[model samples]
Target: MPVVIPAAELGEFVTALLNTKIPDPDHARTVSDVLLWAARRGVDSHGVARVPRYLELLDSGEANATPELSFSGGPSGVTVLDADRAPGPIALTAAADEAVRRAQAVGIGAVGVRRTVHTGAIGYYTSRIASQGLVGIAFVAGMPNMSYPGVTGAAVATSPLSIAVPTAGSSPVLLDMATAGIALGKIAQYRNAGKTLPEGVAATADGTPTTDPALAKMPLPLGGAKGAGMSLVFELITSVLVGAPIVSSFHSDDPQGRVHRQNALILALDPAAFGDPAAFTEHVSETLAALQGLPSTGEIRYPGQNSAAIASKRAAEGIPVGPKVWGELEVAAEKLGVAVPVTPGG
Candidate 1:
C-alpha cells in the first residue's frame, strides 16, 4: 500500500527533516526541492525515498551538513567548485547556476564540482539550465556500485549523464540516463516493494546474474561494453578532472582510500551565441512536432514529456509514496522530532 500526501506537505516534511541534519537553511531547501521534484516527476528511486540513506550518511560524517564551499575561475568560461563534502543538491545547484551565468556572458560555460555526496536526479540540474534558454549537459561520477562488462563484482559507478535542450514550451527536451542497466537506487526500491530485480539488470554477490533483489550486489551496464566504457570516460572527465578521483581510489589497497565523495561536470551553451535564439526555438519546435507526428503503433513521447505530465498530475492529486518509504519517513520524523503530514482518509 502507498500513502498519498500533498506536494506542499511533503516538501515541508522533507525540508524539516533535512534541516535537522543540515545546518544551512538554503542548502536544506535546495535539497528538499530536488527530492520533491524527483518524487513529483515519478522518479521515486531518486526521490524522497533516499532521505533515510542521506540521514545515515550525514550521521556517519560521510556527508557534510554545513560545508564551506569555494568557487574558483579557471580558463575562460571555466569554473570549479570545491564543495568540501557538501550535499549533492547544494553543490549541483551552485554549479548549474554558475554555468548558466558564464554561458550568458560568453558563448559557452563549464563548471566542475568536487567533493559532493550523492546527486539525486541529474535532470533536475540540467533542466534548470535549459529553463534559462540554454543547452545544458551534466555528468556525475561516484563510488563504484556497478560491474564492468565481462568483470565480476562492483567495479564502476552507475555514472549518470543528462542533457537538456531549450524548447519553445515550458518543459525542455531532457534526456537523463545512467550508464548502468539500472540504478542502484531502483534496486533498493525493488527490495522495498518485495519485488524481484529485472533480468540482466543485476548480479548476485558472487557475480552470477540474479533476479532476487535481496541477493543482488551489483548492476550491469546499459549496453555491455559500451555503457561500461562510457562510465569510465565520465569518471575520468568529472572526478579525475576535479582531482577527486573515485574509481582508481576505490580500487586502491589503502583501507582509508574509500570515501563518500562525488564529482560532476556541468556545461551550458547559449543558443544566441551560435545564432538567433528565435531560429533555434523554431527549429526545435518543428523537429519535435515532426517526430511526434510520425506514424507509430503507440503514442510517441519525448524524453521529458511523460515526466512533465506525471508531475502535473502528482501536484494536483498527491504524491503516492509506497508503504516502505512512508515507514522510513515516519522513523526519520520521529528521530528528528518533526511531525509527519496527515494523509487523506488516514
Candidate 2:
C-alpha cells in the first residue's frame, strides 16, 4: 500500500539522503525544496521519486556535488551562468535570484544557464520570482528524448517552459508545460506502477507507437509539428544561444557528446517597472475571478489554481507516496544510514 508522509518529515529525509552525496547544504536544500514543491502541487512525475535517479547521477559524477558556478554579462539586463554541471535546482534557483535582482534594478532581467543537470519542475523557479511580485518566465533545453513529427527515433528534447504572474490575495497564476504530449518521467512512473500508457503519447525505440509502458521508449511531441517546432526553437534560444547545444551534441559522433546536460533561460519582469505593482496584482486577481465565474461543465481552473489548492490540502493532510517510490526511498535511507520517516498506519 502507498503511504502518506508529512511534508516536513519527507523534506528532512530527502535532505538527509541528499546531504550524504552532496557536500553543500544549500544545494541539497534547494533540490529537496523543489522536489517537495512539485509533490505538494500533485505533480508526482517530477516529485521525490526522482531522488534515486538523482543519487545515481551524483554517484556517477554526471552531476557535480559541489559546483563552482560562474556568471557573466550583467549589464543590459542579461547574464550567462556556467553551472559546471551543478544539479538543476541549485543552478536554476541561483539563476532566478540573479534575474530577480537584475529586474529590480532595471525593467527586466534575463539569465541564461549552461551545463546543468535535469531541471526538475521549472515552475518552482518561476514561482519563486512571482513570490516577489515580479512576472517570471523560464525555458529549458535538454537531451533528445521526444520524437519529432518526421523523425523516426528520438529526435528532440521534451523541452519545458513556465510563466508565473503574481496576483493579489491569492496564489500566482502559473503555466508550466513541456513540448511533449507526455513527459518521460510520467512514462517511468507508469512503468513502475505497471500501468499502460494512453495511445499516441509514447513510442517504442524504433518509433512504433506503443501503449505498453515497459516498451515505450520516448514521448511524442505535444501537437506533433507545433510541439516539435517549439522544442527546436527552445534549443536554439537556450542551448545554442548559450553556446552549449544539447540536442545537436547528443546526436554528434563525439565520444563524450552524449553526456547529459541542459541549458535554460530565466527572465523576470518587474510590474513596478511598467506601472504600480499593487494595481497590477489586483488586476490579475480580478481577471482570475472573472475566469472562475465563467460558465463551465465543471470547475473552471486556471493553470496553477488547482495546484495551489492541492498544495494546501497536502500541507495539512500529508503527501501521498506510492509504494514503489516509498520502497526506493527506504532503500536509499538504508544505504545512507539515514532514518526513514514512518508513514501513518504503515
lDDT of 1 by residue, 1-346 (tens): 7999999999999999999999888889999999999999999998999889889988999889889989986877998999989889999999999999999999899999998999889999999999999999999999888888677788888999999998886578999999988888899888877898889998876678899999888888898888899999999999899887888889999675677789999999999999999899889988999999999999988899899999999999999999888999999999899999988786
Per-residue lDDT, model 2, residue 327, is: 90
Clashing pairs in 1: none
> Which lDDT tens digits does candidate 2 get at residues 88-122?
99999999999999999998999999999999999
Lowest-lDDT window of 10 residues in candidate 2? 248-257
Which residue pairs come into collision in candidate 2? none
Residue 175 deviation, candidate 2, in Å?
0.4
TM-score of each: 0.98, 0.98
| Global lDDT of each candidate | 0.91, 0.94
**Pick by lDDT: which candidate is best?**
2
